[model samples]
Target: MDRAFRWAFIGTGTLAKKVAREITASERHVIATAYSRNREKLCAYCEPYNAYPAISIEDAIDRSDVDAVYINVTNESHYEVCRQALELGKHVLLEKPFTMNASDTEKLQNLAKSRGLYLAEAMWTWFADVPLQVRAFVQSGKLGRIREVYMSYCAYSIGYAPRVSDPLLGGGALLDIGIYPITYAYRLFGFPLSITCNGDIKNGIDYGEHIVLGYDGFDVKMDVSIVDTKGEAMIIEGENGFLANPGYHYGESAVAKTKSGVDIFKGQRSYLKEFDSVADEIRQGKTESSFIPPQATLDCMRILDECRRQMNLVYPFE
Candidate 1:
């Protein structure tokens, strides 16, 4: 690891720009290439970063200068981009939700493992340091026997977002914003013994949903929506007390409540720390992140698929 890891960005959107800026500012990596559906927009977007505007997605993955690819493409295209990137013998940092369904995600995960290449989900919550602390609190044996978990992530997706309302594009509230709370529940409880979910469907897309995952002795209750939703509280309740985050998706801090006392930790949040972790792992010749494990991403998608099934939500792409 004598030099920086060059990243080829597959999507030239706001998130891509943000990631590039953070990587550059941190001095841990460099943006080597950029690709987008719109060639004109791609060239213009790469101008500020001085990265190569790739001729195609394949060109971006096949670039000799790039050590890895940062895929921020739409939900529908995530599986294809990830598959092509790994096939080209390159590492991949895929966007969240991994894919539209669990089957595609399992295939990609198997591909990455078979290739001995690094593949990870770019879920900012997993990368952020704050959630790690909350996880520690939950696992520290301080909360006693886990009783129940509660989570919710709901937002109103308004205008100009194709992937949120278009069925053909894999747009839905469950895939877009709901997956956060779903991931949190999975992180704490793993796969549930039984799951009962109810959600709204409009024109083959999911508008909102409520899910109850039954465990051995506890249950996980969660709700998400494209329109307004309930409170944003992610808590893991136990016999003795509880461990909570104000929100699961953008978890900014950790809160602990017990009979003796209460403790709260609101740590600093930034995107640099996670990208730095990826750079370090790549330099060490590692393929997957210890923080954002590949299986967790797969299991989260499974839960999402079940929810979609209960809601009878169908996407045109699937």
Candidate 2:
């Protein structure tokens, strides 16, 4: 009910630090506390924001001044930490790979609903403006009926070495990076009727994957890889023409072409605009976030769950 929500960040890592920087730069929210098991890391992460670093996770959640908690920990830790925050009656914003599977995502959603608290998956890409524009183009009949979508997200992260290969940590191209392309497709087209995925696994974790999602009237083909670099774009094909996004993750611009001609749309970092939605949701005590709702997260998890099942892939936590 406060005019500006007080936020506690659960992980003092690189992503958490970036969120803190953005929160500091914004007026809608303030970083009141931060926590990590390591005191030094906690301090280093909170220094720029001038936030109080909690000695324990419980202390961070139990702080009366904190209105929301941002869970930016590892994939396996998302459910536990967010559960703790929601149990403490604090709204939660979780980093993606919301859970190791759909069951945990369902549990979190049920808990938040019962507690009258807001729980959002921080899939910032969904909140980006390019997708909204693309949606409008589809609905406007500018591209006619959407027939197919193609998305690819790939990058070389060999410098991380063992971390990239570690199965226990839930490390893989799919969960780590593929979620983007999959979620992008889902956001535009909804859950597919069926999915077939093939991946190359090294040390029991998928290093790269190619997924084919089939819908009633359309299909989606997506590829994600951590072993190599890709063009990293999304193409939404309609009956008439298609909309092409050169950079799907944080699309700086998009080009829409139809039987008529071509139209280009440009913008700044899409993630920043997405962050504003979070701020508005928390500040207003809104139960639902229009950006990425709980059901959408659940749907995404179900698709990932099916993909994992078909590929015979299981995370350590599962």
Candidate 3:
């Protein structure tokens, strides 16, 4: 029998609402409690899902019923929430942009490993089903040594929220929305031999970034920006065929073409995949999630750190 795991949410925001919506759809996962600095907001948010609305982070993690915690708070709060949860012997699934830097990410990963606990970054693409097909398409020899790949995810949000534009909260295009393009390039080709980055900055935050990742065999052109909302998709070109993916961030079903014809792979999965993955890992007493492995998260953080270094993008808190 599988353990129908009880989950605690550390922050009540739009993401928490999303988690609540998805948790009800998973048989093995149920949100047991929720906590936000604003207690009334927390109670109102969790009531629909029958979750105990706690008053603080400590209260949520201290619940005996909570098997794991889903940390979907702001980027700045990721490390602290994850650290506290791990210390309380709770498994953690963190939202993307794992931490302010790779150092914190590595430290948390080490802590989880040492404690024989499970910790996973909630990078939904890793748990999605289409990325497997996307990887297969890249490795199938059908593309025949992808010579050139151009990918961009432009999120031009006018009048963005404070968290999106605040440096103290780890706000920037690279960490907020640019991570998708970087992850795409990293997924197909390993870390680049050389990376070149340029960004538009205002109010100590990067509104947009154009990145060029040079591999030994090929080069990837990636542009991600919140300043310019044009061209919000990805294109991978090879000797034989190319893949056209719109909104590549979520692993949406995409189309690949070859000489014979275009082969489209379509299978839409849910955000619950991450929740299900962690629950099963905890049920089996596993220390790591195979879906969103720790090393991959570290790799992502390392790439972002380097990108920031090149762009001279630094957070006040860091």
Candidate 4:
């Protein structure tokens, strides 16, 4: 087997720990170094994986052994951290909500392109087999002419996760959780012709939103909330029948119901696939991910930007 892929982790938060567990367990990946604002936390996070604790972001990425950086920093810090990694010539795998907005996302993409370094959004849904099968089923004419799509990613993160309600950290329901359903629609149907959004905003943070992505012949309706728990099922309606993807963002399976019969597509729900795929792409000297292409990320960010515009929701820094 080839040498394990080396990674420098830039954040040791809850999400970072989860990823660390998955990535380190695989033979194809290992954490070379880690950095966090809290030194104690960083040390503790690195101890479990036997990874080095770096003093700073630059220290972590500037190492000769570190081939890529997995950035799970706060939503507000994505662009700068990713930019810094790319500038240092390390490939980057950034967590979701890409960069707070499309402009920053595009900048990072262009920077990666110019530097000849690998860059990807780390939107795991796009790499999952179920969603890919669902997209293929939709395009195979088995679903017939698409009529409408409905998706919801509502969860009560505001009360439990303080960062979800903090505007200074680029917090809000739209950026925190809405991207799942929006990206789902975009992956299946491409860019929309128009977008209409309505939401509740308080204390400079959004609580929830209802978005309609208008396509050529149909509209995808999506609802996202951070203060309440609604269902998170993605339903695709077509002339033949309908398909339902539960927990669409991170789900492992999707079921399609049609007049002929029912079809089920299932896949693994592991971060290992995500890390391994990215490592393979980088090893092959690719500058962009085929799974979550740069255009798709930019288009989704543009959609999020539009939603924020309609609702007049802006982060404190922006």
As for lDDT, the candidate ahead, 1 or 4, is 4
lDDT score at residue 225, model 2, on the 0-100 scale: 86
Q: Give the per-residue lDDT of model 1 (tens digit) for 1-318.
A: 457778999998878878787778866688889899898999998898788998998987797889889999988899999899999999998998799899999999999999999999988887876777777777777888888888887767734477678887788788888888878777766888998889888778878888898988888888787876465778788988987787556758777888758978676566777778887888889988988898899988998889888888877656
Off by over 4 Å in 4: none
Give the CA lDDT, 0 to 100, for residue 231 in model 3: 63
Model 4: which ten-residue window has the lowest total lDDT?
A: 156-165
Candidate with the greatest TM-score versus the true structure: 4
Candidate ranking (lDDT, best to worst):
4, 1, 3, 2
Ranking by TM-score: 4, 3, 1, 2
Deviating ranges (above 4 Å) for candidate 2: 1-3, 158-164
Q: List the residue pairs that clash in candidate 1.
A: 118-287
Q: List model 2 lDDT by residue over 129-164, tens digit each.
A: 766776666668888877888888888874574545
Clashes of 1: 1
Clashing pairs in 4: none
Q: Tell how far residue 187 is off in model 4, in angstroms.
A: 0.4
Which residue segments of model 3 deviate by more than 4 Å?
A: 1-3, 158-160
Provide the lowest-lDDT 10-residue window in model 1.
Answer: 154-163
- Name the weakest run of 10 consecutive residues (lDDT summed) in model 2: 157-166
